[model samples]
Target: MAPVSNNVVGIDDDQRFALMKFRRSVRDVLKPEHNDHFLLRWLRARQWNPEAAEKMLRDSMKWREKWGVDTTLATWTPPSVLEQHFPSGSTGFDKEGSPLIIVPFVGLDVWGLLHSVTRTDIIRLVLVHLENYLTLARKQAQTHGPTALKVTVLFDLEGFSMRQYAWKPAAEMVFTMLQIYEANYPEILKICYIVNAPKVFSLAFNVIKKFMHEYTISKIRIYGSDSKKWQAQVLTMVDKDQLPQHYGGSMVDENGDPRCSSIVKPGGKVPKKYYARNMQNEAKKEYTKVTVKTGDKHCVDLLCADGDSVLRWEFGVEGHDIKFSIKRRDQDGNETVVHEPRKVSEGPPDVGVLSVSGPATYSVIFDNKNSFLRSKKVYYDVIISVPERDLNMSDEPEDLEAASAVAAS
Candidate 1:
């Protein structure tokens, strides 16, 4: 394989100089093994602008420190529910020696899984696995060359259902994962093969792909349930010995099962017994408690100055139910419903994350006007996160603000 560096192929003298400049700008943080290949990723993501790439790199480094990414693989253990039902595994390496990840997409029970664990737990679980795989890729790169520093994924979406994602919380988690990956782990994927896709998958992808970075979107290939077409393509990149028997490869599990359950866990519906609401002492102390009286509403105005910023919220009502929704109010005072109002009960908290297009005010409203007698007590936390690529380290706090209002009837 050819050396993976900016010096190869279509890159010219100007691009090479930009890459060199980016490397020098971040010299204080780069490891001895952090070669031109690694630096090129950030540069390309920032359109070869060394200064923009530098800010992105520094922001990502801070994010890693905040998440403890360097030590997550050593310290974090996924909850039992995720360990058994996460629906993904690193099964083999591609022809270029990049790790091959297999995900039985249909087995993902997002609704059930969230009910069993916190969203933070799910994010940490993904981070831990990513760290583990990247560590393996880096180690392999020493022998297999720099091309091994990424992963190839196969998403088997045979029985995909849009119903689950239609539920707001499930859709939120999906977009959150996509945004987090694109912001911090840019260019980590060599290619993604999404096979056995149903027609409904297109609708879901159209909505969620808006959250993905261009580099990530360009590497994805989607195909229908034609086994002959996809299997042949997969075989060209992965040897039969490395892939599982179920996916047109010769490898099988210890007991001769074709699905290779030993390596790739087949995630299923999480049992209701594992629901977090059933577990005691689940509330965090950080939530702000607010009382919404009958014939009144509580609204939180999150001002977003930039497009592609994320708005996330987690809240729960005590003893009863409250109608929750999100509305976007543009500069002209035109109001549009972002999330339609729905009744949220006193279990597991109504959690959601949105990639909002802004220069608009987003109102997270808890409505109680319909109730003639009951006053709901709501505990909540709402936040706005700007993309790492767009962060201005010295900007004032007013760029993002969350102000609360209690409107009485």
Candidate 2:
């Protein structure tokens, strides 16, 4: 027996509708290879709920637009900041053809690295890697039948501390990253092992896990870190030669040298020249203050008159975190969010900037929806600027004010 429908062979009505909506919204970015298998990954992540799955897919597409992520996939290079701070990489494939990516946190310069890059860059870097992972997964799936569009994450948490995960900004970033992963990337992580976790590392993760969805939380395993038990389980998944020597695995090549070229050893110094330029965006900035209590909200509306204009923002919090978004209202009095919801940050930390695709009222939302007992105090500022341009219509120019309006249509 077999299922049959206009939908993929396995998906139902709701899942099919979700896929249809995604194609309609971002048809330009779609490649022929983004077939049912890709759709199934998003469908399964939301447990086949059409509405939830559609929103996740939409948000992800909008995010891709603002970040120029689609173009990044083809031509983007990893920023040096990522290479210097984040000691993570894909080593090799497992028996099932799933890629294995390892992140060694022991003695890593997490604090220095966290401050070195803005939240957006961090997200961008992670997404780039994920995009790369998907590329490999798709190729492997062709050779080997049926595969989950996900990767195995091995988080080596040895010697992690308050200085690393305890920082409010860093913790918030991790939480936001988790939210993005669960809502958009969904089910993309095949499995995760928090190996070599020091007891204190639990303190930091306890707070971070609160933001993770139940489905994702279920896939995580905190095993015997830095012990025989950890190595045993890791070896079962990855060959010893695929691992680094310091972790009791072999990286030695046939000539008695390092064999694995993909592995990245933990730790590196970001040169002084790049540090200041990297931190310049995050340096001292002014902010406006407002309070939003539970079920309450504070919104900042920035109006742009032309497409290609930029809306940039920066903010900080006093007591609790707030949800942030960029939204525009359609003619039917409906709101379509323009940027993926900000899952982390007091606000951009450095600056959150998006180039307007059309003239519209871009709303910056400070939602305290998750807070219960207290009001969140947020200090922020936004700048909307545009370059002058003529529509180049007729000998006489049309009103410049019509720039954004014309673009919106």
Candidate 3:
């Protein structure tokens, strides 16, 4: 018999039998019950020609290598490399052309007593206000370009010793901001915190460093008091230089020698373990007692007095509120109706919005008329709600189920 050309061939009886056997073997290996029907069809469609089938299999393997096939598929495209599909100034833009704003609030004192509030609780409040601020910022930016506004929070540490709760609340706030920023706004340029003590700044910067490392954030700048310069520099150093080394681990040659040769051995600086231990010890110190004559007295005292007084007052009864809510536009075109209202008061100068995520309208309502209360106090209220049905996750069950099944397989 004449040899068949590579492009065109007639299947002889022997060839046909071999092809049938191959199909049977493939089918047996990939049981229909175990494999998807579409996958089976795909396999069968490529079985007619051996070269085409081999090419298809090689292509599929390459695809699997390129895209991955794990249960929870993760395709990591670096931010710098990824296509900027959306137009410039699309989402997450402030009026002043900043990407997004994350305001971290420790408490109301800036040096006052540590309130009897949990770090988690404070973070929740900050998140609520942040959402409202972002909603307002986004609308304002869209309508009137960008505007410059710093989201400030009073970190009172009076009655509470700085050693006790300084880093804890600050760390929590930074972590929460990181989570919200990662989930919603990847383009956030700056995060500002109106902090009191140098230690609190250090603690918050440590948390920020952690997130910066995890997310590969290259540039981070902090502006605070001179006392915090050391802490800020530490954060910048850890973030810009050390974190990558830690995560990547010591690179070793085939013989296991460290890849980078150093003339001077690195040691003698304040180690993280020791630093953490010291912070914990400081936190355990006894706080000075402060007289809270009225709700506003603590605030006034902290702001007016020296640094020592401010730190002491934070631990005292300085009223502060942290709230979380979605800002939504009502039918009448006004941003109102914040979901889940929570109030925490420690004197006046309300701790405004901390961080916001997702899409919604937010409004900062000041109690202009103190009709009910005789004292002239400023408190902030937030309104948050979803704008469209598409944004709601109620109808994603079927897709979720399919994905879950695929994942299990």
Task: List per-prediction Cα lDDT, in the order shown.
Answer: 0.80, 0.63, 0.32
- Candidate 2, residue 255: how far the Cα is off, in Å: 9.1
Give the clash total for candidate 2: 3
Residue-level error in angstroms, candidate 1, position 269: 0.6
Indicate the residue-level lDDT of 200 in model 2: 44
Clashing pairs in 2: 196-225, 196-226, 288-380
Give the distance in Å from residue 100's predicted Cα in candidate 2 to where it truly belongs: 0.6
Question: Which of candidates 1 and 2 reaches a greater lDDT?
Answer: 1
Can you give the lDDT of residue 90 in candidate 2? 63
Provide the TM-score for each candidate, comma-separated. 0.68, 0.58, 0.25
TM-score of 2: 0.58
Kindly list the per-residue Cα lDDT of model 2 for residues 1-409, writing each as its tens digit: 1111123466667767776775565556545775656666666777765566567777777766655667754575656767666667766766567788877766355456555655556666777878788778767766654453467778877655544443335545665667666666766676788887765455445445655777678878897554687777777867776666645477753444352323554655555555533544554545687878887988888766665654556667775477877798644567788766765455334344455645568788888888788788788777665422311111111222256479889
Model 1, position 111, has a per-residue lDDT of 81
Mind sharing the TM-score for model 1?
Answer: 0.68
Q: Of the candidates numbered 2 and 3, which has the greater lDDT value?
A: 2
Distance from true location, Cα of 376 in model 3, Å: 51
Q: Mind giving the per-residue lDDT tens digits that candidate 3 earns over 1-409? A: 1111222134566655545544554553342222222132233345445445434444443433332322223332322111111011111332243333312122133211113223333333334435455445444444343332222122222222233223334433434545544433332333332323343344334424534433224344344445344334434322322211211223333344331113111111222322211223344434343332222322111111111111111222233333323334433566554334434355432222222332323343222122233333332222222112112221112334468789999
Per-residue lDDT of candidate 1, residues 1-409 (tens digit): 3334433456889999998899999999987657788888898999999999999999888777666677554687778987888888866898989999999989889888988986667777878888788878887786787788999999999888766664445655666677668778889999999999986577457556777888899999899999899999999889998899989898898878798877888899999988874434445348888999998999999998887676767789997899999999999999999888889999776655676877999999999999989999999988666644433222111112212122321
Which candidate ranks first by TM-score, i.e. highest? 1
